[model samples]
Target chain A: MDVGELVDRAREGQPRAVARLISLVEDAHPRLREVAAALTPHTGRARVIGLTGPPGVGKSTSTSMLLSALRAEGKRVGVLAIDPSSPFSGGALLGDRIRMTEHATDPGVFIRSMATRGHLGGLSWATPQAVRVLDAAGFDVVLIETVGVGQSEVDVVKLADTTVVLLAPGLGDGIQAAKAGVLEIADVFVVNKADRDGAETVVRDLKQMIAYARREIRGESWRQPIVRTVAARGEGAQDLVKALSEHHDWLVSHGELERRRAERAADEVAAIALRELQARLTDLHGGGHLPAVAKKVVERELDPYAAADELLAALRAGRG
Target chain B: MDVGELVDRAREGQPRAVARLISLVEDAHPRLREVAAALTPHTGRARVIGLTGPPGVGKSTSTSMLLSALRAEGKRVGVLAIDPSSPFSGGALLGDRIRMTEHATDPGVFIRSMATRGHLGGLSWATPQAVRVLDAAGFDVVLIETVGVGQSEVDVVKLADTTVVLLAPGLGDGIQAAKAGVLEIADVFVVNKADRDGAETVVRDLKQMIAYARREIRGESWRQPIVRTVAARGEGAQDLVKALSEHHDWLVSHGELERRRAERAADEVAAIALRELQARLTDLHGGGHLPAVAKKVVERELDPYAAADELLAALRAGRG
Candidate 1:
């Protein structure tokens, strides 16, 4: 399809076209960039909620419940499930989109599972693009469920309008709290599996931890709400949603919401450009341009560093 | 303390000088880029090995053991231990670094415990640059240790020549072998804590899974060796080291060694560029250029897609 037509269909909320368009964008150079340039205007229309936590923490379930609530409000929701995959392997490992039963039949709910796939953040290179797609397509909300937490998942903190971190009970008991990097990134924390015995305790502990964290970060006054949710039963989800609205309000009042979106926008553009340069560099390096240098360095004819410097200089000069 | 003098000292094998100089280069931008360009001739010297696994899987123990054996051969070693920190709070976290005891008073070993405070993948922006410093400082081997078995840790697979995926006795069982992403990236598979009862079972399971993976990925015959190691007691460590050497030879003989290095070099350069752009873009966007557009966006006075288009146009026009 022509780029214009493809964007039009994507804007029309065509899921297959949206997926194909992202594929084309991921594989292309100047055209994908032009597409990004075109889609930027549509980005802020859909409220993006990032759902993240450790694996098996009920993030997926909570996302489902949130999506259901948004749909009930007569809103068109787009679900972007980020999976971790090897670009070398071209796989989206462990996407649980199949588990989102309600959205399968809801035409208004467009669900697309993407992988960082060597894209570096457990998010698709075209994630911001795809979110724009959902936004332009008139989706009321875009819900992103990430594969796991920590560094890669933090990408969502910048990308999303709100980030919900899900934690199960018993997580705060051991050394797990030491590893819970999501505590700070979360706009709202969901103690999922509230039927479990330690739900209240987890909430209490998280509140205290957040309090300590706020004090340490030096004047971070917006308190991250700890919402207890039995996602399996869809309990406390409305409260979670309310917490999201409240957080969004807080961001607006504190002047951080725009700050973050701008940050993400800049990153999105730069990443698109670097990805272009990378693809070109790969072909040159793989075409035996560097092997002779490697052989010479291995033989001590010259050091590897000098050889690399020479190789890059040659590539820059187009003299190799 | 000047860069030139520091470089001189590092070249003369002064570890502290090397570390401090690399820190300066890393902490400063234009200086680091210029110095990195100048020092390009001395890097890619050390054989980099990235060790990753699920938390509490004895990654540090294996690293310490591996460092000892490498030291036994009179090989100088550098261990870069990474702890992932919480993003929101910016609190130091995941301190599994206490498990290592290899570098105390050993001139042959340099251990740096780094926090994944800013960026993820268990490496700081300074990591590759630091590795270059250590390489120039004449460390025979560089060992990078990451905290988790997730996408961020996968960065090691590309950064290191030989990537070891360490698995303990019981965490994330059955599903691990099914993790085609991490499993496929491993050059050496280590079931660390092999004295544990389920060690043999995990190995058997991994072997089967690897066999299936080998068949599935089709061509490009790279054999991944599964080495069972009781890391705490230093049992089977020699065998692990031997397998690493065997893999190295296999990679070289098959010409994969050169290919992989070329790929890593390209990735390293690209990642560096991407990181720089991310920082730059963040600065530019935060500096009051994009807020008017963002305000219009938040108030819904104009749609985001169109606003983004306008923003880009303004960016190109050097006005907003």
Candidate 2:
């Protein structure tokens, strides 16, 4: 488990090495600290783009279309498909890796599906680390595709430099997008399934919502562009590509890119710090202290806040 | 603002005082410590029952019906409806409070809908506190209902003494339920809208799944009963109530009730302790330390793990 050798192989565009490093990240390997330090200097070159929408919106098709479009521009791309494991759908609707077989043998493309199940903090904890692996692996573009605009999906997209929210005709998605706070997080909006009957209505509704949002935001904010896409046929992928490029240019020119990356890094660092502290807390008093304190709280003999104080005090004392 | 006076009025069953106390908990007020301490002594008497299902399953109607049945038994019931603010549906489909107007004027029944939108840790952090408020207010039964079987909903039901997972015919919910791991968490299953077509199919599928699960889990496990009801017509409410009572008896007799409560309290205490530590971490170096560390990570001058270590070390030094 020589992290430097592994990282070196990953940087050389070895697919197996890249996959292994991400697996290490996903498993929270013991040498993760060493791996992170090894990969750090080679990272920060990939541009992250997030695509999200409700079910039945053709998110996977759109992602595959975008990947092809980016590859056509001679850019190496990495696709991280996040399956949030919907309680309603049971799992992701799109068999993304299967749909992406066209690029499977290409050295320039990397595709991985990460399921946010049984992972501590789920998406927020795991997605970024996997993204770091791809970024360090020298991918020019990292596209993160997630199903549904749940809270976790929104958090994942916030890590991207550009977030593209996809909607479609006849899913009642127009009102859902607005109500789900999708307008606030989306840098670019894609009306997928443009070949469908109500595509124009979805686009019009989105336009109105974007216009309303632009007026309310008091700053030099980028006006989100609405692009229509029949992604299944690859009809409007070039337009989506153009929209993404414009957003990325805007981010870099306005210094928003640096600020966003820094903020994302801060969040990542803070989350890791909290997790480390929690692990230590769990290890304290041979891991029996919390359960004992919780017993008293459950018995109504002690309050939760007081119990928390005792746990924190014990943690502090152990640190000494 | 006087914590003791508020707790006193709450225990006296004053609706306004109870509402005020829950609001304090939702807002995470400074006196929450005092409130928890005051409420601790009066807690642990109420039976906490959780009802959850996907949208369009009539969770609100079922909850209203259950409230009436409990009131008929001369029991004061409090309903804590958690709205998880789904990104797919936007908000809860059931205008629960509006639908529960039948019990609005009933002094013996109190209904509250807590939206988990901006609260830190969302449902996990706020629901328990609100439940404590209701329990301390001298309610004999507390019904916690949530729409959708997402992760947060599952976590919320884990706090209950008994969890009822509702499913409706023709929604393809049986497979979804099993896939979503609902079978493991549901202490009881209710097929609402049983008068609809495919009701028998749902019941049959659920029976098979439950039977399979029972075989897998050895020893004194309660077999989850499949209860059918057309909740809109108020049919089978008593049967559902009977099932709940039997489950409660099982829990009490088997000592599982205490075990569940102790586990729930431990989770609550751990969440609070982590939040307290996070607050302290945020308050360090005028809240600028994280941003500084994050900038270094973004510049590839430091890795995230190293940055987390730096943040932890700073917190430890600050504590000393």
Candidate 3:
């Protein structure tokens, strides 16, 4: 089938077609540009929500609960679970796969896992493309879920319209949430397992922290709301949804949504250009200016900074 | 004085001069090429070691003990502690500084903390330059310690001749160490706080894990050694040093040291060139091909991949 037909079928909510397009993106297939070109007209309609937190903070539970809530509202939801794919997970990863079984059979729910183990371009390159695929497939809401407190989670924040940072009591995650710089990114903070003894304290602490951040700021900005949730029991899922909707409303009203989407597109464009440049440099590793400069730097005839300049000059000069 | 004078004084072992040069690196000063050129001949002498693991694993304590052990051998040590600078760790960060006060007054020790906050270049960009500064300053050993298990820690692995992954008993760190992909990077595993009850179990688990890893391998490789240490009391500092020395020796014997250094230099060159290209793209964002392409992509007249290709083509065409 042609790229046009695939995109047409994907927009008709055909799961197989959507998955095929994403695989094309992931693999950087030769025809990826064609597929993306065909899908572009249908993109940028879905609301992208990012869910991130440290491990053992019940991120998955909260995500599952949120999915059910969205589905109940008659919204088609797509989930992209970003797994670090640790070889050490052994059997635990399988356990996580089982937790999502509730939504596995739902036609409205399209769930997929993207592993970071072997991707050279990294999560930043693949994620936005997959998000576009889901968005083009006509999903109303796309949930981007990532575990741990790391740089990749930070990248996810850029793609999301509303970011929910989940924390639990007794995990010391409140402080971690602050330390990992997650506090600055969260649009809504959810204290999952709110029935626990210290869950209230977690909520109080998050509010105070947000207050402190607000005081440090000069201009008008969204004040992140903290909500209490017992996600395992689905108690506060409604409140969580409400907060998300409010944030989304604020984003749209403030004209920030357009700015954020433009920034995301700019970043995507820059990353692809960078990767292409890197590939070109790698291709010139032997019998080229790159190796010559590298050899000089390695032999102490020139420093890396100087070598880099010489290499860049050569690359530019060759354009002649 | 000028950068040349700073280089001269830094090479003469002036602590302030060394500190200033590193600050220039961290700041990405415009004359960075000049400084790197001056320091090239003096680089490659220091024994670079990377210490990393999850938070609350007593990484700082272990680092202090290792410093003392290396100091006892009459070696000059320069430590570049990569602090995540989490706003939540206002108190704990101070505690870490206090822990290193024992060697603060020693002329043989130079400890500097590099905060990741507000630095757009990131740890990877600044770290190798700082290491070059320390290496040129006559330090016999340079210790690069970073907290948390993430992508930055993986970057730390590339800069080290030997990487020691520190873990503590009862922290569930053994499994975490595996999950974070630190298992593959470790040349030596130090189980800090060996006097604790679960210390023996941690050691046993690590050995069995390493054994399992070895069984799956088809080629000859360095077998990671696990050493137990009560770092707070400095009980096993001797053994830790022994393990590091043995790993260093193996790195030399197998010629992996040369390969690693070449790879590091190659990465540095690529990073600098990428930064240059990114700067050019940013310049083009306002009135050139980048913004033009971005607008078309945003409007769905062109896809991001196609737009990126156009931008690259424009860059290449301009080089002509």
* Candidate scoring better on DockQ of 2 and 3: 2
TM-score for chain B in model 3: 0.92
Q: Write the per-residue lDDT of candidate 3 for residues B1-320, one digit (tens) a residue.
A: 48788999998899999999988888888888889888999888999999887667788889899999999999999999886533333345556767888899899999998866545446777888899999999999999987754565457555888988877777654564464355677889888888888888888878777887788752557888889888889888999999999988888999988777777777788778777777777777754667677777778888898889888887776556
What are the TM-scores, per candidate, against the unseen true structure? 0.81, 0.95, 0.92
Docking class of 2: medium
Indicate the TM-score of model 3. Answer: 0.92
lDDT of 2: 0.84
Per-residue alpha-carbon lDDT of model 2 for A1-320, expressed as tens digits?
88899999999999999999989878878898999899899899999999988766888888889989999999999999886654554543544457778888889999988866656666777788889999999999999988653566668888899999888888753554355377767889898988889888887877777777668763566888999999889999899999999999999999999999998998888888887887877786357998999999998889999998999888887777
Best by lDDT: 2
lDDT for B207 in candidate 2 is 83
Candidate 3 docks at the CAPRI level of: acceptable
| Each model's chain A TM-score | 0.87, 0.95, 0.92
Error of 2 at B13 (Å): 1.7
Q: DockQ, per-model, please? A: 0.19, 0.58, 0.43
lDDT, residue B245, candidate 1: 88
Model 1: per-residue Cα lDDT over A203-263, one tens digit each: 7777778877777773776788888889989999799878988988888898888777765
